[model samples]
Target: MNTLKQGDAVPNFTAKDEQGNTISLSDYKGKKLVVFFYPKASTPGCTVEACNLRDNYEVLQDQGYELLGVSADSAKRQANFKNKYEFPFPLLADEDKTVINAFGVWGPKKFMGKEYEGIHRMTFLINEKGVVERVIEKVKTKDHAAQILA
Candidate 1:
C-alpha cells in the first residue's frame, strides 16, 4: 500500500461513526487531529491501544488534539466496543474501506508467521491545516498516547 506519510494532505472524506453519525475530515479543521486506524474492534491488541488513548484522553485534549478511531468494523460492533470501553472519541465504522483506502492503511500484514491483507495499525497527527505532521507506524499498544504526544 502507498501509505500516506508526513507532509501529505489527508483526503477530505466523510464516513459514518459508531453512533452512525456522519463525520468528515473537514469537521476537524482548525484543530489538531489524531486519526488512528486499527484492524478490528474488540480485538486484544486493538483494545489495549484504544484503551490507552481513552485513558489519556484528557492529556490529548489538553495538548489540543481531537481523536478519531477507524476500523473496518460494522457499526454495531464499533458501537459495542466504544460503549464497553467508554471511549470519548468517535470510532469510524469504515466497513467499506473508504477511509481506510483514503489513508492507504489497508495492505499486506503478517501474524503468527502467516501473511495476509489487513488494515495496518497506524496513527496520523494532522495539523490545524489538515496536513499530516507525523505518522506513527511503530505503535506501542500500551504506550500509544505517549508515542503520539512524543
Candidate 2:
C-alpha cells in the first residue's frame, strides 16, 4: 500500500463511529489529532494498542492530542470493543473502508505465512492544519502512547 507519509495532507473523511455519529476530519480542526488504524476490533494486538492509548488518554489530552481509532469492523462490533474496554476515544466503524482507504492503510499483510489483504496497523499524527506531521508505521503496540509522544 502507498501509505501516507509525513507532511501529506490527510483526506477529509467522514465515517460512522461506534455510536453511529458522523465524524469528520473537520471536527478536529484547530487541534492536533492522533488517528490510529488497527486491523480489527477487540483482537489481541489491536486491544493492546488501543488499551495503551486508553491508559494514557489523560496524558495525551494534557499534551493536546485528540485520539481517534479506526477499523473495518461493523458498528456493533466497534461498540462492543469500546464499551468493553471503556476506551475514551471514538472508534470508527469503517466497514466500507472509506477512512481506511483515505489513509491508505489497507493492504496485504502476512501472519504465520498466510497472506491476506487487511488493514495495516499504523498511526498518523496530524497537525492543526490537517497535514500529517508524523507517520508511525512500525508501531510498538505495548508502548504506543510513548511512541506517539516520542
Candidate 3:
C-alpha cells in the first residue's frame, strides 16, 4: 500500500459526505486537519476509533485540528452511522475510493484466516499548509484520541 509519509503533500480530493454534501480538501485550507480512513462504518474497531475521536472532538478542535472520517461505505450507510453515534465531525462516503486511493490506504488486509483487500485504518495529520505532519499507521482503536494527541 504505498502509504503517505510525513513531509508529503496531502493529496487534494473532493468526495461526498454522509449528507451527500460535497467536501473538498481545499475547504480545510489554512487549518490543521486530521483525515482518517477506516475499513467500514459501524464496525467494532471503526466504532471504537470514531467514538474516541468524537468524545475528544472539542479538545482536538482546541488544538486547532479538524477531524474527518472516511470509509468505503455508501452515503446512506455513512449517514446512519454518523447519526447513530452522534459524531460531531463529517464522515466521508468514499465509495469510489478517491480519497482512500489518493492516500494509499486501500490494499490487502487480513481478517481471521482470510486475506482480502480493504481500507487500512490510518490517519494523516495535515498541517495548515496541507503537508502531512504525521502519519498514524499503527492505530490504537480504543485509545485513538490519546494516540493522536500524544
TM-score for every candidate vs. truth?
0.98, 0.99, 0.98
Off by over 4 Å in 2: none
Give lDDT tens digits, candidate 2, residues 1-150: 888899999989999999999999999999999999999898999999999999999999999999999999999999999999999999999999999999999998899999999999999999999999999999999999999999
- The RMSD of every model to the true structure, in order and in angstroms, is 0.6, 0.6, 0.6
lDDT of each residue in 1-150, candidate 1, tens digit only: 989999999989899999889999999999999999999899999999999999999999999999999999999999999999999999999999999999999999999999999999999999999999999998999999999999
Candidate 1 C-alpha error for residue 15, in Å: 0.3
Residue-wise lDDT of candidate 3 within 32-126, one digit each (tens)?
99999998899999999999999999999999999999999999999999999999999999998999989999999899999999999999999
Q: Which portions of model 1 miss their true places by more than 4 Å?
A: none
Estimate every model's Cα lDDT from 0 to 1. 0.97, 0.96, 0.94
Q: Candidate 3: where are CA atoms >4 Å away?
A: none
User: Candidate 1, residue 142: CA error in Å?
Assistant: 0.2
lDDT comparison, 1 vs 3, better candidate: 1
